[model samples]
Every structure is written in structure tokens, then in C-alpha cells.
Target: MHYLLRRLGFYLLAAWAALTINFFLPRLMPGDPASTLFARFKGKLDPAAIEALRATFGLTDAPLWRQYLTSLGHVLQGDLGVSIAYFPSPVAEVIGTGLGWTLFLAGSAVIVSFAIGTLLGVVAAWWRRGWADSWLPSTLIFVGAFPYFWLAMAALYVLGFTLGWFPLGHAYSDDAVPGWTWAFTADVLRHAALPMTTIVLVTLGGWLLTMRNTMISLLGSDYVNLARAKGLPSAQVALRYAARNALLPSVTGFGMALGFVLGGSLLTEIVFSYPGQGYLLVQAVRAQDYPLMQGIFLVITLAVLGTNWLVDLIYLWLDPRTRDAGS
Candidate 1:
């Protein structure tokens, strides 16, 4: 209980610090949001209009401290201000529109990749010197060496454009209505397949390699030897004794990956023109949409912190040492 409380407190403090930084970083940028918005209109708007735009964005020429306080209060109230990129639309609404797509795409990829890679790693390690160890990891890692966006481009061109095996972009087929219908769900999955494959291929090798090495190291540990000595089934010894312990490091990586899913795959989304948070973030940056950018960053930070805290709690359950130490 004490350990969980401490971790919670730490995350809260970290979130506060992240919020403060998110608030200031945009303000300290070379130009103000109003100026940027005005430039987008080719400066036809007068200086007085700029002030009005600033006021609309909740920007004030007040003291830095006062502005900070006001910003903090608004954030607490879930008022992320109007997005200049999406003029008159609140940041929350814009984010909410795209958040589901981002979650579905990135979240599915992370989880599936983790499960598949971890299983492969266990097999590769347990059957060391076999084909799985010698062949699979090397081939996958070789492909994984390419950047995610690079792979995304290749996949898009080959699978989407050249072969026409998948749709070119977007979350669903153009004609499909957005609803709970099987047709809409099938279209959504079809659109997601390429991007998800890109993410899985790019990330699978890391998890495979990490788990393989960890499992191999644990295979020779005293407890593993004891399990073998006890005449336990080979599968039980391998899984319950060796693979379970070896998975600890990957657990942390999985948690981080899960958290980052909320941020979406920026390059992959851009390459595929997927309508996720990453694409929205690009639009926000291009339009100098401070409120949108800040809201996205805040969401990402909170997600990461929240997932890490969850991982810590999992650690206490998975590893007895954590519980003992905490006690």
C-alpha cells in the first residue's frame, strides 16, 4: 500500500511538472499563436484583430505568473481553448474525434507484437541453436533495422499502391458508414492492416531479441536448475521457471509501448495519411495550434506516467522481491 501510494504521488508530481513545461514551451517559442494565425491569412488582419484572436485563444498580455495560473485553472477545468488549426473548435473535441483511431491502431499493434514476439523469443531461447534462434530473429531484425516510416512507405507502395492489396489511406473505405455494422468494422480493419503490420514488423525484433537474451540468461540460473532437478515437465520448467522470470524487462517495455500508443505512430500515420493523433499533431504544428498541441502533449504525458505506474504495480505482483522490499 505504501509503495503504491509513493508511486502515485511521484506520478502526480511528474504530471504537474510536465503540465508546467507544456504550458511554457509554446509561449517561449519565437512567435505568438496570434501572429502565426495572422500570417496564415497573409496579414490582411489588422493589429487590433490580432489582439482579438489572442483573446479568443485565451492568450493575455498579463504577467507570466498570472497567465500560468489562468492556464492551470483552465486545464483543470478541461478547457483547452479553441484550436486555431480547427478554428472555433475546442481542443478537447478535436482530440476526442481522433483519439479512438489512434488507440485502435497503435494499441492493437503493440499488444499483438508483444505477444507474438515474446512467444517466439521463448521458443528461440529454449531451443537454442535451432532454426528459430538462428534464422527467425536475424531476418526480422534485419528488416526491423529500417526506420518505421521507411518500412511504412515500402508497405504502402507495395501492398497499397503497387499490388492494390489494401486501401491507400484513411481509417475506412470511402463508402462505408461509420457505425457498428459489420461492413464498417471490416472496412476499418482493412484500412488498419497495413499500418499495423508496419508497426508490428518494426517493433517485433526488439521484443524478440530482448526476451531471447533474458530467457537464455535465466536458463542457467539456480532456480531453473532446481526446477529441472525436481523432475518437472520440460514445458513447465521452461515456462513457469525460466520464461516467466525472463519476461520482467519486457514487461516494462510493453507498458511503455502501450502508453505511447495514445500518442499514435506519428510517421506511420503521416505515411499512410491515417486520421490519428499523429496526423492531427502535424496539422497542429503546421497551423501553430498551441492549444491543440498542448492538449495532445498533456494527454501523451499523462498516458505514459499512468502506464509506468501500472507497470510498477504489476511488478509487485510478478516479482516477489518488490513486495518484500516495499514491505
Candidate 2:
């Protein structure tokens, strides 16, 4: 209990540090976001209003300490200020609109890949020296080292250009309107297919490699040998004894995936012109949409932090060793 509490306290401090950096780091960039946005309207806003713009963005001709405190307060209240690029709309709204697509595509892909990888790892472990056991690790290592954008590139070339089968870009076909209707949903899926597939392929390999390695180590343990010598059915021993214990590493990886669902694969989105948060982040950074960038960063950070928190809880369930230590 003491150790767990200590870990929790450290993570809490880490989260606060992350939030503080997220609040101010963007504004500390060399260029001013407000001025960047106001570039097009040189004479549109008179002197007073332009000065007000400085105040609006917390760039007022005031002390840095006061501005920092004010910014911190606003951040606590979930007011990331009006987005300079979008003008008038709150940063939250922009993030809100894009969050769904991000969660749907990235979240589903992570879960699917983790499931498939875990199954394959278990099979390889159970049937060691079999065809899959010999071949899967080599293949997974190859794929794991391959860059995600390259997969998107190849898929675009082969599946899209050469065959004209899957979509080449975007979250949906041009005609598909945003709605809850079945037709719209189908179109979204159809458009989502290629990107999601690429994401899965890129990520699945890492999980397989990690889980397979752990399984190999677990195979030589006394517990596994004892289970085998007991004359239990091979299937029962394999699953109930060996695979269950080997799954802890994979579960940790799953927690990481859950955390990263908001931090979409940036290059993949860029290649496909997908409007997920990753794609938005690229543009936001380029245009110096500081508030928008900050919002996305915070959302992604919280997601990962929260996922890790749940991972600790899962550890207690999957491996009672942790709970035993607690007592």
C-alpha cells in the first residue's frame, strides 16, 4: 500500500508538470499567434482593438508572473481561450468536433491489433517449434521496424492506385454528410478502412514481438513444467497455466495503446489527408494556432495518463503478485 501510494503521488506530480508545460510552452514560442492571425487584417482592427488582442491572448504589456497565473487559472477552468486561427470559437469546440473521429479510428485499430497480436502470440507460444512459432517472430520484427507512413504509402499505391479498390484519402467519400444514419456510417467506415488497416499493421507487430518473447521466457519456468507433468490436457495446461501467466506484458502494451488513441499517427493522417486530431495538430503548429495546439496536446496527455492509471488497476487483477505485495 505504501509503495502504491508513492507511485500514485509521483504520477500525480508528473501530470501537474505536464499540464503546466502544456499551458505555457506554446505561448513561449518565438512568434506570437495573435499577430500571426492578425496579419491578414493589417488595418482592420484599430490600435485599441489590436492592443485588446494582446490582452485577449495574455500577451498584454504586463508582468510575466501575472500573465502566467491568469493563464493557469483559465486552463483550470477549461478555457483555453479563443483560437487565433479560427477566431471567436473556443479551442474546446475545435477539439470536440475532431475528437470523435480520432477516438473511433485510433481506438478501434488499437483494440483490433492488440487482440489479433495476443492470439497469435499465444498460439506461437503453445505450439513452440511449429511453423507459426518459427516464422511469426521474424515477420513481426520486420513489420515492427517499418515506418507507419510507408505502410500508408504502399497501401495507397497498391490497394488504391494499382487496384483502385480501397479509398486513397479522407475520412469519407465526398457525398457523405455527417449524420447518425446507417448510410453515412457505412460511408465513414469505407473511408476509414485503409487508414485503420495501415495503423493496425504498423502496431500489431510490436505487440506480437513483445508477447512472444515473454512467452518464450515463461515456457522454462517451474510452474509451466509442473503443469505439464501433472498430465493435464494440453489445451487446458496451455491456456490455464502458461498463456494466462504470459499475458501480463501484453496487457501492459494494451494499456499503452489505449493511452495513445488520442495521439493519432501523425504521418499516416498527413499522407491520407484524414481530418483526425493528428492532421489538425500539424496545421495548428504550422499556423501557430497556439491554443488549438495546446488543447490537442492536453487531450492526448490526459488520455495516456489515464490509460496508465487503469493499467495499474488491471495489473492487480491479472497478476495477483501485485496485490500480494500490497498486503
Candidate 3:
């Protein structure tokens, strides 16, 4: 309990710091959204329009501290200001449009890859020198050696463009209606398959290698030897004793991967034209959409911190040593 409280306090502090940074970083940049919009229009509007634009964007000539407090208050109210790239649209709404696609694409890929890779690692380590142990790691590493964008491009060209096995991009077909209907769901899955596969292929090797190394090291530990000597079932000893301890490092990695799910695979999204956060981020940067960018950054920061805190909680459950030490 004490341990979790301490961790919760730490995360709260980090989130506050993140919020502060998110507010100020964009202001420190070369130009504000109002100026960027004014430039785009070639200043044809009334000169006073720039001030109106600034005001709409929640920008002010007040002291930095005052502006910070106002921005913080707006953030707490879920108002991230109007986006420069998407004029008249609130930053929150723009992000809301893409957040679901990103979570479905990147989130699914992370969970699937983590499960498959961790299972493979456990199997390979439990049967050292066997077929899986000898073959799986090298093969995965070889495939994973290629960059994500490179693989995405290759897959897109071959499977999507040339072979026409999958749709070219986007979360669903243009004709597909957004709903709970099976047709829409299937279309969404079909569109997601290529990019999701690319992400999994790129990330699987790291998880597998980490788990395999940890499992192998744990297999020789005294606890494992004792479990074996006590005539425990081979599967039980391998899983309940060795694999559990080996999973700690992989859990940490999985948490980080899960957190970044909101960030999406940038290059993969670009190649596939997926309407996710990564593509949105590109649009934000290209248009100098400060509010939009800051909103995205804040979301990603909170995600990372939140997932890591969850991982810490899982650690307390999985390993008694942590609880004992905390006590």
C-alpha cells in the first residue's frame, strides 16, 4: 500500500511537470498559431483578425505565469484550444477523431506481439538446444533487422498495391459506415492488417530476445534447481518458477510499448496513409499547429507515465520481494 501510494504521488508530480512543459514548449517555438494562420491568409483580413485568432487559440499577452495558469485551467476542462491546421476545430475533437484508430492499430499490435514473443521465449528457453531455441531467435532477429518503414513500404507495395491482397490504406473502406455492424468491423480489421503486421514483425524480435535471455539466466538459478529437485512437473517448474521471474523485464518493455501505442508507428502510418495519431502528428507539425501538437504530446506523456505506473503495480503483485522491501 505504501509502495503504491509513493508511486502514485510520483506519477502525479510527473504529470504536473508534463502539463507545465506542454503548455510552455510551444510558446517558446518560432511562431504562434495565430501568426502561422495569418501568414497562410497573406494578411488579407483586417489587421485586428490576428488578435482575434490569438484569442481564439487561448494565447494572451499576459505574464507567463498567468498564461500558464489559464492554459492549465483550460486543459483541466478538456479544452485544448483551436487547431491551426484544422481551423474552427477544437484540438480535442481533432485528436478524438484519430485516437481510436491509433489505439486499435498500434495497441492491438503491441499486445499481440508481446504475447506471442513472450510465449515463444518461454518455450525456447525451456527446451534449450531444441528446434525452437535454435531457429526462432535467429529467424525473428533477421526479419526484425529491417527498419519498420522499409518493411511497411515493401508490404504495402507487394500485398496492397501490386497483389491487391489488402486495401491501400485508411482505417476502413471509404464506403464503409462507422458503426457496430460486422461489415464495418471487418473492413476496419482488413485495413489494419498490413500496418499492424509490420509493427509486430519489427518489435517481436526485441521481446523474444529479452525474454529468452532472461529465462535462460533464470533457469539456472537456485530456486529453479530446487523446484526441479522437488519433483515438480516439468511444465510447472518451467512456468511457475523460471518463466515468472524471467517475465519481469519483459513486463517493463511491454508497458513502454503499450504506452506508446497512442503515439502510433509514425513511418508505418505515413506509408499506409493510416488516419492515426502519427499521421495527425505529421499534419500538426507541417502546419505548425501548436495547440494540436501540444495536445498530442501531453497525451503521449500521460500514457507513458500511466502505463509505467500500472507496470509497477503488476510488479508488486508478481514479485513478493517488492512488497517485502516496501514494508
Candidate 4:
């Protein structure tokens, strides 16, 4: 209980710091988003309209500290202001439109990669001299060494453009209606396949390598040796004894990956022209959409903090040592 409380207080302080940073960072950018927008219209809107645009974006000429408080208040109220890039759309609405797709694609990829890689790692470590240990880790790690965006592009060109196997871009077939229908779901999945593959293939190696190393070290531990000496079943000794201990590091990594799923893969989404949060971030940056940028940053920061907190909770259950302070 003490450990958990300490962690919770630490995370709360970190969250407040992140919030303050998010509020100020966008304001420090080079140009005014309102002026940029007005310029795009060739001054057709006159200076008054331009100032109104600035005010709408929470860019009032009030003292910096006052504006900061206002921004913080708006965030608490779930009002992220309107997006200049996506004119007339509230920042919340813009993010909401793309958040689901980002979650679906990146979330699925993270889960699948972690599961497959961790399993492979356990198997490889258990039978160190076996073929799975010999070739699988080396091959995947080698492949993972390549740049992620490069692989995404190569795959997109070969599979999508050349063979025409999957979608070239977007979240679904243009003809498909947005809904809970099977057809819509299928189309969404179809479009997600390539980006998902890119993310998984790139990330799968790290988990596999980390788990393999951790498992190998644990297999020689006294607990595992004792379990073996007790005449436990081979499977039980391997899983319940060795793998369980080996998985702690992987759990921390998985939690972090799950948190960033909301941020989406910037290059992967851009390569495929998928409208996920990453791609939206690019748009926001290009258009100097401060509110939208701040909103996205806040979401990513909160996600990371939240997932790390959850991992700490899981630790209290998984490792008996973590509970000792309270006990």
C-alpha cells in the first residue's frame, strides 16, 4: 500500500508537469496560427475577423499566466478549442474522429506483437540450442534493425501498389458506410492490415529479444531449479516457474506500447495516408493548429502516465516483493 501510494503521488505530480508543458509549448511556436489562417484566405476576412479567429483559438492578448490558467481550465472542461486546420471543428471532435482508428490499428498491433514475441521468447529460452532459438531471434532482430518507415514504404510498394493486395490508403473503402455493419468493419480491417503489419514486424523483435534474455537468466535461477528438482511437469516448470518471472520486464514494455497506441505511428500512418492521430498531428503542425497540437500532446502524455500507473498496480500483484512495504 505504501509503495502504491508513493507511485500514485509521483504520477500525479508528473501529470501536472506534463499539463503545464502542454499548455505552454504550443504558445512558444514561431508563428501565430490565426495569422497563418488569415493569410491563407488572402486577407479577405479583414483584421477584425483575424483577431476574432485568434480569440477563438484561445490566443487572447491577456498576460501569459492568465492565458495559461484559461487553457488549463478549458482542458479540465474538455474544451480544447477549435482547430484551424480542420476549420469549425472543435479540437475534441477532430481528435475523436481519428482516435478510434488509431486505437484499433496500433492497439491490435501492440497486443499481437507482444503475445507472439513473448511466447516465442519463452520457447526459445527453454530450449536454448533448438532451431527456434538459433534462427528466429536473429532473423527478426535483423529485420527490426531496418528503419520502420522504410519497411512500411517497401511493403506498401510491393504488396499494395505492385501486387495490389491491400488498400493504398485511408481507414476504409470509400464506398463503405461508417457504422457497426459487417461490411464496414471488414473494410476497416482490410485497410488496417498493412500498417498493422509494419508496426508489429518492427516491434516484435524487441520484445522477443528482451524476453529471451530475461527468460534465459531466470531459467538458471534457484526457484526454477528447485521446481525442476521437485519433479514438476516440464510444461509447468517452464511456464509457471521460468516464464512467469521472465515476463515482468516484458509487461512494463507492453504497458508503455499500449499507452502510445493512442499517439499512433506517425510515419506508418503517413505512408499509407491513413487518417489516424499521427497523420492528424502532421496536419496540425503544418497548419499551426496550436489547440489541436496541445490537445494531442495532452492525450499522449496522459496515456503514458495512465499505462505506467496500471503497470505499477500489476506489479503489486505479480511480484510479492512489491507488497512487502505494506505487509
RMSD of each: 1.5, 2.2, 1.2, 1.5
Across residues 1-327, which tens digit of lDDT does each residue of candidate 2 receive? 665676678778877888788756765778776677677587787778777877777787668777888887887798877776677789888888678778888888899999888888888877888999899878876776787777789889999889999878888888778888999888889888988888888787777777777887888899888988988888888788878888998898899889888876677778888888888788787777888888899889878888887888889888888988866
TM-score of every candidate relative to the true structure: 0.96, 0.92, 0.97, 0.95
Per-candidate Cα lDDT values, in order, are 0.91, 0.81, 0.90, 0.89
- Per-residue lDDT for 1-327 in model 3, tens only? 988889999999999999998877777877778888999999697779999988888787988898889889999999999988988899999999988888889989999999999999998899889999999999999999997788899999999999999999888988889999999989999999999999999889888899999999999999999999999999999999999999999999999989988885788788999998999999999998888999999889988999999999899999999998877
Which of candidates 3 and 4 reaches a greater TM-score? 3
True-vs-predicted CA distance for residue 113, candidate 2, Å: 1.1
In angstroms, the error of model 4 at 311 is 1.1
TM match of model 3 to true structure: 0.97
Candidate 4 deviant stretches above 4 angstroms: 1-5
Q: Please give the distance, in angstroms, between residue 121's alpha carbon in candidate 2 and its true position after superposition.
A: 0.8
Which window of 10 residues has the lowest lDDT sum in candidate 3? 23-32
Candidate 4, overall lDDT?
A: 0.89
Tell me how candidate 2 scores on lDDT. Answer: 0.81
For residue 326, model 2's alpha carbon misses the true position, in angstroms, by 3.6
Clashing pairs in 3: none
Ranking by TM-score: 3, 1, 4, 2
